[model samples]
Target: MSLSKLKLTTCLWFDGNAEEAANFYTSVFPNSKVLHIQRYLKNGQELHRQEPGSVMVVEFELDGHRFVGLNGGPNFKFNEAISFQIDCANQEEVDYYWAKLGEGGDPAKQQCSWVADRFGVSWQVVPTAMKDMLASEDKAAAGRAMEAMMHMKKLDIAELEKAFRG
Candidate 1:
């Protein structure tokens, strides 16, 4: 969606690395770019304590979804409760995203297709077919697929399909 057509934008709080995070995100996704970067000014220096010229907010879009990264300071941290999900069309897409997003991430948090990036942003990389596999009318098939998925870190589409068919 175009920036003008965006009804709501997600603002992500960062710790003095809003621009860097925005660059990283834009590089990872196709059709994405850093739309704008705003730096801090003297107006709120006393309250924010940020360098006058330091990055304040970065507005960017990832495959049409607009996001804002704000250098809101060290008061907040990203948690696993919230994450972005990438639906892959096949195994190749899944592998690509898993490796890219999972780079430099905490290994402990890499499980069941969920990965925490270097900047502590969490993402889920799953094949598009996964939705159908896990929601099939056949309860037994769906259960098998679910069980197989639980043991995986990056999702395996072939394995999930095999289990579902069994």
Candidate 2:
């Protein structure tokens, strides 16, 4: 069967802390919630279930994307190769996300479009008007806006528009 036809889901593997991480994520994003949780038990006795309180699997949705969190033991870690991008309308949105996600995490400078959160989850927080401006017929304006954007940590839509007009 083709992978695309197999009801593909993004499965996140956590180091024995799937439940905690899921809850944390749901709290951070709007319209997010933990859909269901499953526990592992053996025979008549709950082995991993009764100890350490690890979650076998947690189904959740963040900003409408369905994801599964598995307490698969710390066999892997999150990397920047894959990341979630947030398109914001203003600086307030950018700052809010930067502060919330950057807590306890390192931030990598990527102009006004990117930041890596504490959990090694990289995010690109960009202005919603970026596409419109970049697609403008005015090449000089688009280039100027792009230059301005490349120097910011958090995108400012107003500033970009100003640059575009210059």
Candidate 3:
């Protein structure tokens, strides 16, 4: 949705890295771009503790999703509780995102198609077919798919389909 039409947007807090993070995110996905940037002014420097002209906020969009990245200092940090889910249509799509987002990320956090990026932002590179496979009317098939997915870090759609058929 366009900025004016949108009612809500995700705001990410960063410790003076909002601009860099916004650029990184826009580079990762197609149809993404940085919309605007707001810098700290001399008047607000006392409260923000930032140099005048330093980046304060960056507005960006990633594949149609709008986000505001704020240089809100280190008081807040990102955790696994909140994550962006990317619906991939195929293994190739999943692999692309997995490699891109997982670069310099915590390896231990890579589980169930979930990865915490270098910026400590969590993302789930999931296959589009996963929901349908796990929601099938056939309980046996659904259970098999679910079991297979549990052990996967980067979901393998072919393997999930095989488990569903079994």
Q: How displaced is residue 162 in candidate 3, in Å?
A: 1.5
**Could you tell me which 10 consecutive residues in candidate 3 have the lowest summed lDDT?**
1-10
lDDT for each residue of candidate 3 in 56-127, tens digit (9 for 90 to 100)? 999999988899999999999999999999999899999999999999989988999999998899999999
Best first by TM-score, ranked? 1, 3, 2
For TM-score, candidate 1 versus 3, the one ahead is 1
- Candidate 2, 19-131: lDDT as tens digits: 88788789888999999998865543443343443468999999888999887766688887787788777778877877777777665534467777655667887767887
Residue 19 lDDT in candidate 2: 85
lDDT of each: 0.93, 0.78, 0.93
RMSD per candidate (Å) reads 2.9, 4.0, 2.8
- With a 3 Å backbone cut-off (N, CA, C), the pairs that clash in candidate 3 are none
Instruction: Estimate candidate 3's alpha-carbon lDDT, on a 0 to 1 scale.
Output: 0.93
Ranking by lDDT: 3, 1, 2
State residue 150's C-alpha deviation in candidate 2, in Å: 1.7
* Model 3 residue 79 lDDT score: 92
User: Candidate 1 — what's its lDDT?
Assistant: 0.93
Which runs in model 3 stand beyond 4 Å of their true positions? 1-6
TM per prediction? 0.95, 0.79, 0.93
